[model samples]
Target: MPSKGVRVFTYIAVAGCSIELSVPKQTVVRNELNTFWNGDLEVDARNIDSLFNKKGRFSFKVLSNGRLVTEQWIDVNAITGNASGGTMDTIASTPSVFSPNNDNIIVTYGFYEAGQGHDVLPNQHQCYIAVAPNYANWQGKLAPPGSAQEGKPFNRLVLPSAHDVGMNSMQSSDSVLKKVGGAIATSLVGSHEAVAQITDSVSGPAISLVAPNIIFSLAITQKDSLDAMLQIGARYFEFRPAHCHKTILAAQALPDRLYFQHSAIPGMAYDQFLSDAVAFLLAHPAEIIVVQLRWDGVPAECARPSDQEQREYLDAALKQAQGQIVAGGLDDLRSSTIAQLRRNKKRLIMLVSVDSLSTYTDAGNATLNGDSIVAAFPKVLTAANERGKAFINIQCQATAANITEAVVYSVLDAGTTTSCIMATKAICDSKTLPWCRDNVLRTCDNNVLVVMMNDFIDGATADVAVQLSKQRLEQ
Candidate 1:
C-alpha cells in the first residue's frame, strides 16, 4: 500500500518463531508516528506458550528501501496487557526505546494469544507497529554550544513545563481532613457537589468524608517525579506552596511546614521538592530549570503564614540549591542563552509572586516577580501575544464531562478511581498533544515561551517542544 519506489520491512522474532513483514512507504508526516500494521500475526501454539511460559524477548528491525532504519529488543513481560487492545500511540511508551538515529521510525508490537477474546484478534495473535519521533536527551541535543539555539534568548525558546509540578503524590482523606478542619473541608466539598447529593444522609456522610480526597484526585496534574520530569526534557516547573496550619503541625508534632497544594489539599512537602530538584541539577550540569512559586489560594478559614515566616522558610529551602540558582534580574535572564547559563554553572531560575519578591531578594537570589510571566490556558493565547514577556500556555484538554465522570465513578467505586483518572488523562493528553502541534505551536510567533501540560506530563509534550524549538532555530 505504499507509494512507488518506497518500501518498509519489519522483521519480528518471538521466542523461536520469526516473521518478516514488508510495508511500502505512504506519506510520512513530521512529528507524527505512522502505524503501519494493526492486524494479527498467526503464531503456533508452542511459540505462543513459550512467549508466556518463559521470559522470552522479542526483537524487531525496521528497514526502508533495503536500508535498516531502527532495531530494538523488548522483554515479553514489558508488553502491558489490556483487554481493550494495546495503545497505538507511540508517545505513551518510554523515551529510551525511541530510535536516536531516526526520529520518524518506531516499531511497537503488542502480543495477544488466541484463547484471549480480544476484539481485535479473537482467534489470532495481534501485534501493532508504529513510527514516532525519537526524544532521548532532547534538551542536551538541542542546545549544545555553537548550536543555533545557543544564541537565542532563554525566554524565547519553546520549553516544556509542568503545571502544578508538585501534585504527583496521592492525598488521603485523613491527611486532607487534618490539613483543613472538617467544617472547612465539608464546605469545599459542598461547593463542588450538587446540593441534593450532599443532603442525602446515607451517602452524604461517606461523600463528605471522601470529598477532599476526590477533589485532590481531580487536581493532581503530574505523576512523574521531579528528576524524571527533567530527564524527559521539562525545563520549567510551576509549584503552588501553601503554609500548613500551626495547629495541625503542632497536633502532628511537626515543625513549621510548607506543603505543595492544589487549593487546600496538600501533596508533597516543599523542602522535599527542592532537594530532589537540586540533586538533579548537580548531576546534569548542562541542564537548566525554571521554578515558579506561587501561593495556592486557600479559603478564609485557612490562615496564611506571615511574610517573615515564609521568607525564612524559602531562604532555608533555596539555600540547598544555591549553587545552581541563577542570580540575575529579569532582563539579564531574558538575554542569556543556554550555553551562556551552562558556562556560568547557573542553571536554575527562581520566579516568585509579587508578595514573595522580598523573600527571594532576602535570600540573596536574583529572581523575577510574577509580573514578568503570564500563565494562561490555550483559550487565552490571543490575549497573551505580547512580546518580551514570558508566557506559560497550559495545554489542557480535559472537559467538564470527563472530570464529572471521574468524580462520579470515583464515588461509586473507589478502587477504580486511580485507573479512571489515568485513562481520562491519557485520552485528554492524546487530544492535547495533537492540538498543540497543529494549533498552538504551528501558530506560535515568539510570544509563547513555555508549553505546559497537565495530568502526568510525559515525553510526548517534550517532543512537541523540541520540534517547535528546532523549527524556530532553523528559521
Candidate 2:
C-alpha cells in the first residue's frame, strides 16, 4: 500500500508469491468512463491532471501462492525517479504509470478523454481501487427487498399497503425509476436537474449515503473499518430527496464530526454514559440529540403475552408518561383503549407504533396478523376524534394509515418485507377477521399517521423532528 504519489517500481519476493516490474514503451492510460489520458507520454507540466509525454513502458506479473496472477503495466519516459509513494511513481518530466501493488488490489485501466489531445485525469485515473483488506475471503450476501428475487435479501423496503393498493395509486402517478434511451448513457452525465425531476416525481422513503469511509477508518480500527464499506452498494447513497450531509448537520446544529458504535454495554459504564448524554441534551436544549440503546442483560425466555396482557403493559407505560392511554386486546382498540386515551388527551397524547394484527415479524416471527393490527389502529383515531389529542398510528403498513416513507426504508433495509406482507395479508384476506371486511387498504385522514417505527434509528427520526420543529416554529 502506498500514498497517492509517484514511486519507483520495487519487487519483494514472497516464497509463494512474487511480483516483477518493467517499463514497456508506448502504453496508453485511460479512466473508467473510457476517457483518454496521456495518449503519448510527452513530458509536460501544463496538463498536471493529464498524462504527460513520458516515454517508456513498465509492466508486472504477480503470482500468489504459486498461482498465476493478473498482470499490469505502466508507460513512462526515461524516468528519473522522484520519491515514489503508495500507488504512484513520479517521473521528472513524463507520464507516470503505476504498477500493481497487491493481488487483492484491482485496477481497471481505461482511456481518459482529452478535448482534442491526451491529458492526465487525476481523479479517476490514479488510485481508482476499492481495497478490501480481507476481501479475498469475504463473500457478498444477497441484498434484501430491493433486489429482483424473493427470500434473497434486497436493498429496498416493502410495505403491506404499498403491495395492496400502492400499485394502483402508482399506476396513475409517475415512476421514479425512469427509463433512459440507449443514446444517452455514453454521451451525457445525465443532467443534475433531470435526476431531480425523477426524485421529485416519486414520494417515498429516500436513501442517502450515511457516513464517510475515510473518517471511519481514522476513528475505528481494522476490525470495524470494513463494516461501512460492505454496506455501500446495499444501502442507498443518500437519505431524503433534498437532504444531504450538510443540510442534516445544519438542522441538527451539531459539531462537524460524530461517531457511532455497535454497542456500548459491558464495554463502557452504561448508566453513567446514559446519564452524561441526558445531561448534555438537557444542558443544550436547542441542540437535537441522538442516542443508541443496547441491552446487556442475560436474555430471558419470556413467552409472548396475549393481547390483554400487551395492552395492560402499554397502558401502564402511557400512564407513566402522564398521557392518555389505550388497551385493545384482540379486538377494536376503541373498545379497549380509546376511552382511556381520550381523557385529557389534548396536551400529552399517547400513540403506539405496535404491529396490531400482524401474523409475522419482519424476521419471520409467525405470531402477528394484519387484521388484528388494523383492529388496534383505530383506537388512536378514536382518541383523536373524541379529544383533540393527536393519536398517530405510526405503523409502517401502507394499507393501514398515516404511514411514512421512513418506515418503508426500514422494512426494506432490514430485509423483512416478505414477513411484513405475510403478516398483514393474513389479516387483510381473512374473511373471519373483524377488521378485514372490505379493508384491503384503508384511507387515512392526514392527521392520523402510520409512522415508520424503524425510521427513528436510521436518522429518519431527525427528519421528522426537524419537520415538527419547523412547523412549531412557524406557529
Candidate 3:
C-alpha cells in the first residue's frame, strides 16, 4: 500500500480572501455533449467586510494540451460573514473539440472580483483530465423526474455499495489484540482445547499475540473514508456495530460504547461513522444513500443491551443527524423514486434487523427489516435473487477464504508477505464492474439492485453504475 500522495492545493488572495481547489488527480471523460467534469471550490471572503454583498466571480476553464476546450463563469454575492462552497459540474468539452484521441486535458478554476481578469490567480491549480472512449459521472448522475427510468422502483436501480463500509482504518496494535484475544478466550475457553492451551501457554506467548494480527489483517475490507467513498459514487453502506473492547471486557451494557467492526476487530468509532454520513448527506442535495446496520461480533461474555436500550442509543445518534433520513415505512420507501426522495429533502434510508425495526420505528425514524432488503455473499446471488427482494446487496468480498489465506500466509511467511490490501485487490479486481456488468448484471434477473465492492473501491465502479442507469433510462 504505497501512498498516492497529496492532491490538494490552496491559494491565499489579498485581504484574507482565500480559494481552495479540490479535484481528482485524474478524471476520465468521454468527448460528448452534456458530459460534465466535477470538482469542488471553496471561497472565503469573510475577513473583509467591505466585500459583503459585493459580487465575485468563479471561473472554470478546461484545456486539452494547451488548447482551450471550454470556459464558464458563475457570479455570486459574497455573504456578510460566511464561507461558501459548491460542487462545480461544468461541461468539459463538446463533440466538435474533444475526442477519444485527445490527451493532457487540464481542468482548473479560480475566483476573483466580479470585474477582475482571469490572470488574477496563479497557474499551479490545474489537474489533468484523462480522455477515454467511454465516460460517466462516477460521483452522481441520478435519473431525474420525467425520464424513462423515473418510475422504476428501488429494486431495479443499479446502486454501488461498499462492503464493510466502516473498515477504512483497521489497525493491529497491542491494545487491539488484547481486546480481540479476550473476546475469543471468553467465548471458547471450555468448549475448545486450543483456546485453553493458548491461554495457558507462557512459553508461546508470541503465538497468542500474533494470532490477533492475522484476524485484523483479514478483517479490513475497505480503505477509503466514507466521504471519499461517497465522492466516488457508493450509494449504500453496511455498518456492523459491536461493543467496544473495554466495555465487552467489563461485561457492561453500555449502549453508546460501540464501534464499527469486521467480526471481532474494531475499526472506526460508531459516532464518527454517523457524523461522516450526516456531513455527506448535507453536502450533496441530489444524492440518496442507504445505510444498513447490523449487530455483529459481540462476545458471548458481554452483556447485550435490551431492545429498548438499543433503541434509545440509536435514537440519540439519529437526532444528531436529523432531517436527512427518509421518513416512511418499508412499503412506501420501496415504491418511491429517487427523484421523490431528493425532492422531499429526505435522502437517507436505514435498514435494520426485524427485531430492531420496532426500536427504530418508536423513535420516529424511517426503518425497514430484512424482509425489504436481502444481503447475499457473492456465491449465493442466484439464490438471493430468487427471493425477489426490493434491495439485494451482493457483497463481492469472500471473507472466510480471505481470512483463511491471510492466516496461512502469516504462519508460512512469518507475517512478512501477508497483506490485507493485496488479498482484497485480487478478489475485487476479479469481480470488477466491467466483469460484473457482463457476468452478474446481464446474467442475473432484474433483482440486482446494489453491487457492493470490497477494498480499494474508486470511481471506476461508479462509472459502470452510471452507464447501467443510463441504459435503463433508454430502455
Candidate 4:
C-alpha cells in the first residue's frame, strides 16, 4: 500500500489490507510515488466525509531497482459514485499527511527486475488482505448493483459469481456422503480422481475424497459470509445443493433440507444463507443478488440407477431447494423482468439447473437448468457477442479427477498470474463479451455480464473478493 496514493476506507484509518512493501535503504519513497496518484496526495483521516473522496482509477506500481515489476489498480466507485455504502471505522481520529495517523503502508512487493526469471516468489509470509466495510455497515439487506440494474435482460450484466459460495468450511460433521456405486474412491484423490468421477458426473453420490480439516484449507472459497460478499460488490453466487450430512456407513443419513457444499464437505445451511440474503435485500431494497444452483453431490451404491431413477433423484433435490428458497421469500426471476422484480422488492434471482427437465420449464414457474459450465460459458459469450449483450459464465479454473479441492487448487496454482489475466482479457474482449474494447473494456448501452470461477479475482477469491469486485464491476 502506497502511503500517499492509497485511499484508506475504514475510518480512524488503518493501512489498506496489510501489505508488505520492500523499501530500499537509500530509496526515496516520496519522490517515487509522487507521480502515482495524479500530482498531489489529498488524503484525509480525521474527516470521514472525505475518506472516500477520491473518485476515479488509481494504480499501484512496484518499483525495484528503478523498474516496474508488478502493479495493482484500485477502483473506489465500483460500489457507487456517491459512496453511499461506505463508512469509517468507529475509532477516534488521529489524522496525518498520508493518512492522518500515517500508519506505515505495508506491501508485499517483488524485488527482481522485469526480465529476471523465477528467482523470487511473491513472499514467504503468505497472507491475504480483505478490508472490512466502513461507513457501509450491515443494513437489513445487502446491496449488489445487480439488483438496481433495471431493463437488462437476464444474464446481460457484468455479474461475477463465486464458484462455490458456501465452501467457507469443510466439516465432516456436516458431511453429506452416500455409498454411491461410483463415488470417486476416497483412495483415488487428486486430479486423476476428479477426471474419473466426471466421466460419470451424475452417477455417484458426491463424496469427499480428502478428510475434513485438510479440505477446509484446500477448498473453501469464502473467508467471510454472504453479507460480506455483497458489501464487497458481488451480486452473483454459485451454489451446489446437496442432501447433506451423509456420513460414512455406521448408519449414514441425509439432512432434512438441502445444504451448501464444495462436494462432500458442508458449510452453512442453505436456508440460513438465503435468509441472510433476504434480510439484506429487505433493508437495501435497490440491490439484488443472482444465485445459480444445481442439484449436486448425491452418493449411491455401486449400481447405476435407471434413467427414471436419475430423473426422480434430480427432481426431488430441485423441489427441495425450491421449497426452501420459496419459504425464504426470494423471487423466481424466471418469469419476472427487472422492473417487476424491483417493484416487488424481490431481489434474489435464481437460476436452477435440471438437465433435460422439460416438465419444470413447461410449468412456467422457473427456467431449465444450465449445461457443463465450461460448455455453457462459450454459448453465452457467443450470444453476448452476437446480441451485443450477454448473460455468461466464465469457467476458467481447472478441476481435477474427482472434483476434490486439492485437484482444483493444483490446476489454479499451476497457472501464472500473467496467464490468468490474459485469459480473463481474452474472454472479456469485445470479440466475445458485449463491451467496446479500447485500452480497457467498458459496457455499452446494451447489458453485459462476465461470471468467472477459479480466477474470479473480482469477489470470488476469499482473500480479496471485495477489492477485486470494486475493479471488476465497472469492467
Highest lDDT model number: 1
Q: Is candidate 1 or candidate 2 better by lDDT?
A: 1
- Between the candidate structures 3 and 4, which one is better when assessed by TM-score? 3
Worst 10 residues of 3 by lDDT: 357-366
lDDT of all predictions: 0.46, 0.23, 0.42, 0.34
| Model 4: how far residue 258 lies from native, Å | 2.3
At residue 207, candidate 1 shows an lDDT of: 58
**Every model: Cα RMSD to truth:** 11.4, 26.0, 17.2, 15.3
What tens-digit string does per-residue lDDT give for candidate 2 at 1-475? 1111212212121234444433332233222221111122332233233354433334444445555545544433332311122222311111112224444432211111111111111211121111112211111111112222212111011111111110111111111112221122111112223223324543333311211111111111111111221111111110100111232233342222211211100011222222333333233222111121212111121112344643443344445433322222212222222222222232112223322322223332111223444444444334334243222223423121112232222122221111122212222222112232122123223222222221101111112222232232222
By lDDT: ranked, best first: 1, 3, 4, 2
Give the distance in Å from residue 433's predicted Cα in candidate 1 to where it truly belongs.
Answer: 1.2
**Candidate 2 off by > 4 Å:** 1-269, 287-452, 472-475
lDDT of 4 by residue, 75-158 (tens): 233222211111111000101111112222222211101111121221111111222222112111222334443444433334
lDDT of candidate 3 vs native? 0.42
Can you write out model 3's per-residue Cα lDDT over 3-102, one digit (the tens) per residue? Answer: 1111122211112112222222222223332123334333334422343344344443443444454544443333321112333221111111122224
> Per-residue lDDT of 261-319 in model 1, one digit per residue for the tens?
55555567777777677677776665677776676455443355566765675566557
Candidate 1 residue spans exceeding 4 A from truth: 1-137, 171-190, 194-205, 208-216, 245-247, 253-255, 301-314, 317-324, 327-329, 354-379, 397-406, 414-420
